[model samples]
Target: MIRGMRGAITIEKDEPQIIWDETVKLVQAIVAENNVQPDDIASIIISTTPDITSAFPARSVRMLEGWEYVPVMCMHEMNVADALPLCVRVMIHVETTLSQRDITHVYLNDAVKLRPDLITKNV
Candidate 1:
């Protein structure tokens, strides 16, 4: 069976290292919370806001976790009015035995504001 975990986080700053660190931390939490293994991950699609084109967030994550074999792609989010800036989002598809409700989606730091209801639901 297949399951998915979605996570979003905002960079504390526009710097590459800050984005890298935060994304790494958020991905780690998703893996831990959902008990996701590297092999279980089928693919991960990451998107970042337009204001953040300094680097592809997925590259940092891949390097940080040594996910040389995992498939990851990065893209730019659609430009919309009054949208959040300096944000990175991820959708991870994984092979899992758990039910849909068993999966946990995470939104951390300033990103929590994007889905306050989701955070509350998970909590």
Candidate 2:
């Protein structure tokens, strides 16, 4: 079955290095929490808040060894009023046997406030 895992992380600033580092950290946590292997990933979609224009989050994913074959895309998140700033969010689709209820969603740093219910149960 194809499953989707969601994750998000907040960066302290809009610098390229900080964006790259935070993106990698967020993806790493998602992979670890979901036991996701590169081969099993179908595609990864990343979005950042409008303030995060220093770098593309997908660039960080491609930097990971063995992730070259994985499909990844990055875009700007909708600039909604009161939305979290410097936030990067990702949705990873993968082929897995885990049921929806068993799948884990990760929200780290200040992004954890985005899903308090899930944090208490899954993160």
State every prediction's TM-score relative to the real structure. Answer: 0.91, 0.96
The per-model lDDT (C-alpha) reads 0.84, 0.91
- Candidate 2 clashes between residue pairs 3 or more apart in a chain or in different chains: none
Query: Candidate 1: worst 10 consecutive residues by lDDT?
Result: 114-123
- Taking the tens digit of each residue's C-alpha lDDT, what string does model 2 give over 1-123? 999999999999999999999889989888898898999999999999999887888998998999998999999989899999889999999999999988889999999999887884544
Q: Using alpha carbons, what is the TM-score of model 1?
A: 0.91
Candidate 1 segments whose C-alpha is farther than 4 A from its true place: 120-123
Enumerate residue pairs that collide in model 1. Answer: none
Candidate whose lDDT is highest: 2
